[model samples]
Target: MVGRKPERKSAPPTDVRAHVLASATRLFAARGFDGTSLQAIADEVGVAKPSVLHHFPSKEALRASVLDNMLAHWSEALPRLLLAATAGEGRFDALVGELISFFAADTDRAKLLVREAMDRPDEVRLLLTAQVRPWQTAISEYIRKGQRHDEHFADVDAEAYVLHVINLVIAGLAVFDTFRVLLPDASVAESRARYVTEIIRIAKSSLFAGPALSAEPRDPSLEGAPNRRNGTTR
Candidate 1:
């Protein structure tokens, strides 16, 4: 006797949502938030954009969902590193190292972050608000703790220090990768490795009344992380 036909299983709803967000991440990284159309995103995923809308109501929602998921992943992955830095385990230097590992692992998502900071629409601003705000707060408190423990400089300004370190990392990544066409000879891996190391060292350095360290040269990956801060504020 012939066997009965097997039934096909439907794709899980969770899987469908995951695919949509992954597609959105790639498109948003290459095409700016505004540049990326829902239709284009649908085409990338081989589903109707409306199918994407079923999971995420709008493009803004999609971007936000993708970003939130990325943030959640970092939170889950970095518990040990977080404890080391916040609990005064002398791994303050390693907190920024976490950022480097994250960047190297998913360059596009990291690029999307730089892009969000550069041209953030009102909705995308939440991404920075979520990441930068907590980082500034945590770094400030941690540095203050280090100062009390004599681990950091006595007179180091935590706010200024955090901002400077962020600028160094964000701007470092931007300039290296942004202008690659013009500086085609630069190596992103070699240069970014050095820049990340230097930035962490800078964060860990003492704040003597002496002169500051000279600004580091732009690395290949950082070419993309541009700053238009030439006598003009954003």
Candidate 2:
């Protein structure tokens, strides 16, 4: 059991690149992109800087690659989650739940994501376009599609709603580090579910109510909220 020979194992180029990206995601989250050096990323991945640079030309490039990968992962996972996310489970809550779950599940990735979204705003527009929509325009547009057939509230503005949802999701993650200090005992799952449930209640009452629910005493919990068609969160 003493001489383990380092548990020798190897992977293909794609796998290696993924490994580098995952390592960089964690390091960059802890240390900013500028703070995290190529050498440091390479060291964490147990590879040479030259090897890292061979796969990715620069540190920023590597970070961007990780972001891009995550975006792709979300694009694929969203629909499945929306479908499986039941009404009993709280569709509105589920949207919030999923976003928080995503970031909470990947602390380093979440940190890297929020930093890039806020800091490198200029570089992202086109990169995000190609990565998420490509030929589809933008994620905001895709989100708007739900409103056409009353999947969501018809009165709600699509762009506004999309931005609101995106914010609710990412904001949970953005505050994770700070919240860590406050809710140290709360698991990522708990914080996300609670926050998402709160956000959905706010959105449904204020964002979608159109003065109806406002006239009445809104339930603090979304348990009594009405359901929408198409499995969409009302």
Query: Local error of candidate 1 at 146, Å?
Result: 4.0
Give the per-residue lDDT digits (tens) of candidate 1, residues 1-234: 554333222444347678778878888877778899988776666666578899998777898887788778777767855765564333544566666566656767666777877776665566557667887887788678867877567788888887777666655665556644443335766455555655665665543222333354322332233111121111
What is each predicted model's overall lDDT from 0 to 1? 0.64, 0.62
Q: Which ten residues in a row have the lowest lDDT in candidate 1?
A: 225-234
RMSD of each: 10.3, 7.7
TM-score of 1: 0.66
Candidate 2 Cα errors over 4 Å, as ranges: 1-15, 81-91, 127-158, 184-193, 208-234
- Error (Å) of candidate 2 at residue 134 is 11
Give the TM-score comparing model 2 with the true structure, all chains together: 0.63
Best candidate, lDDT-wise? Answer: 1
